[model samples]
Target: MWAARLAAPCLLLAAATAPLDARAAEESEAQPPAAEAPAWSGSLAAYLNLPRGNEAYVTGIAIANRGALHLEARSNYEGMDAYSFFVGYNLGVGEAVRLDFTPILGFVTGSTHSVVGGFEATLTGRYADAYIEFEYVPDAQPSGYAYAWSELAFRPVDWFRIGLAAQRTRVHDNGRNLQRGVFAQVKGKHVSGAVYWFNPASHEQVTVISVAISF
Candidate 1:
């Protein structure tokens, strides 16, 4: 009798909490589905980003290669002085289709900062001399939730190329915006340079210039 009396109030408490849990679950289910990834042709490439802020000036290097398997790793300086590690994998390239997986770890300079993770995915196709890609940013989070980015690139000349891309990012739970950018790259036997322009979140225009050497 004593044990039964002790369990009765606990059961009532659980019954009271159950509806709150069910309501939260329903809300999550009502959200939209994840976006579909873009399409592209498979190629191996290396990228280096030289940023002017954060570390006063920091360089980010990335290498992405394709075979039967693929691996990638990159690091960047965020905002003022924070750094993060992003690692990912690509699969099915040797076959007719491809799949990708990415996991990230982040660190900040201050004690109040929290580490977060984000990832992206893309599918690619080839048509004539042009390649197209559709990409989805799973969750941009501390980097900002730039949800989707799609690109089309064409090689008119062997060492010259042009690309057009569009991106959509969610700034807050109920707010989002779009960005469009154009890029051109010219490669010579030992030197290369690129120019790109885009509109940022604050509705300001920004441009990037990059010069690099080929090994």
Candidate 2:
């Protein structure tokens, strides 16, 4: 009789805990996994203008997770005409599209002393990139102006990309000008470089080369 009573209580205890153990396991399985942490990255770039005989340098840093927040600064060593700082955010629309919005503030050396506001938007995908930008300045030389640029590129190998690029600029007094050209880019693990050559229908030719390093 004593052994029978001991076995009965042991069976009762196991039966009571079995449901609790199963419920815990089910909850664990249903819970989602933790998200990965964000990463920080930065890049430095230099651009050389062949026609203008000027050089511009730019540096930027960003933190990326679901989206990226970045700050960039640019300066022209030959002159201060293109000195500016930009703050921007990059948001992923879906698997292949990313959008960026940035605000620009800069001075036009020997021209407007006041800081002006400018806006830039960029859309990028696997094979193409496009951007529209404009700046507001009361005393700008070309008057109110804006520009749009687009490029479609294909990667034939791991490190080389070839593309066709087009650019349009609209100025108040100068009218609209369009330029089209071909571009090539080569990329390495930590460095990349690109070159562009465009000729306006009735204007001077423009050439630009840029190199960038990432860390």
Candidate 3:
């Protein structure tokens, strides 16, 4: 009878202690470390280019986290001069997928009109010292047509970059057209300048030159 009593108390103690130990282990397993957030960056750029027959100039500014705001004034001496504003958001930084929106105002020789708005999506990839970006713009009226553009940029040295880009546009009613262009750029620590040839259409082209300083 005494031995039976001792065994019963010992079994009860083990059962209670097992549950407490399991609860402690489960508490430890539930806790984990927290994650960190990403940082933001800003940039300003100026450009000059000649697309088929006109001279164009632009000054662009960007203030962004993962998202960006772009504002620019574009002028073509032989054609229309436009002021453009846009918003661009990076879906993933240093990765594929980006989104853009642009609204434009254009004025020329004797007429004025709203250039409408445009939206775009882009994907990017890199290989060795060269990187390529693919962009798709959807169909929009008055100022935009559906288009795809591909660009490749190469870094000859740390602060100098050169690139070439090709674009094709499909109009809702007119027809299909193509543009081919080349660009050369030099970027310092806080400022950058670019020279380019922009052939926006098969028969229309512009040439432009510009300079910008940033803080």
Candidate 4:
């Protein structure tokens, strides 16, 4: 009789809380979805191009991203007095060895006018990163040409990186088709500066200093 009386209150307690637990479960299932990401973000990079025994030039690049949409503009990039604009979509995958890829189509105006199509990719890791971009000007003169730029870099500190850089560009008609060199960069919270010296041993060596800001 004593055991039966004690178990009677325990059974009543569980029976009374059962409706409360069911109500809590139903409320959780009706919760809203996650919030969206920011609407817009962008970065601006300006490079000062200085060549030995040649006139210096300024090249500026602007990139704007809205979610997966990517837009870019280049001033004095392909050649002196030239301009280019691109539109593309960004795709990415992985975490430990992440890769971001964007395939672009654009038009080149001003000095060199053509239809350009290309792709840009970057692979990132804990201490190493690699970036490459390739573009083909199908409508350029004299049967057209392809342009490429790449960097293989390693970070020694949180804010500094040393890298090997290579490019095949016709920005300057100096007969230096493939210029390879080394670069060093220092990064801050929202800004970065890089110095690249291409063909350090040749007479037509080029030095490119670039500054970039993100917002």
> Candidate 4: which stretches are off by over 4 Å?
1-29
lDDT of 3 at 24: 92
Candidate 2: worst-modelled 10 consecutive residues by lDDT: 57-66
Candidate 2 lDDT, tens digit per residue, 95-127?
A: 578877665555444323335566567676776
Write model 4 residue lDDT over 1-215, tens digit each, in one string. 99999999999999999999999999988987788885888899999988888899998999999888999998886778889999999999999999999999999999789989999999999999999988898766666888888999999787999989998888756788788999999999999999999999988899999999998
Query: Global CA lDDT of candidate 3, please?
Result: 0.47
- Which lDDT values do the candidates have, in the order given? 0.46, 0.60, 0.47, 0.91
- Sorted by lDDT (best first), the order is 4, 2, 3, 1
**Candidate 1 Cα misplacement greater than 4 A, ranges:** 1-59, 64-78, 94-150, 167-178, 188-192, 200-203, 211-215
Off by over 4 Å in 3: 1-40, 51-61, 66-88, 93-144, 147-150, 167-177, 198-205, 210-215
Error of 4 at 98 (Å): 0.6
Ranking by TM-score: 4, 2, 3, 1
Q: State model 2's lDDT.
A: 0.60
TM-score of 1: 0.43
* lDDT of candidate 3 over 1-215, digit per residue (tens): 99999999999999999999999999888877565555455554444443443333343333443324333333321123423333444433343433233332222221223333333343333321333322222223344333344555676576776777655533111232656777676778777776656564445664445465655
In terms of lDDT, model 1 sits at 0.46
- Which run of 10 residues does model 4 get worst, by summed lDDT? 137-146
Top of the candidates by lDDT = 4
TM-score of 2: 0.59
lDDT of 1 by residue, 37-107 (tens): 64322322333322222112333433343432333332332322333333344443323334444433333
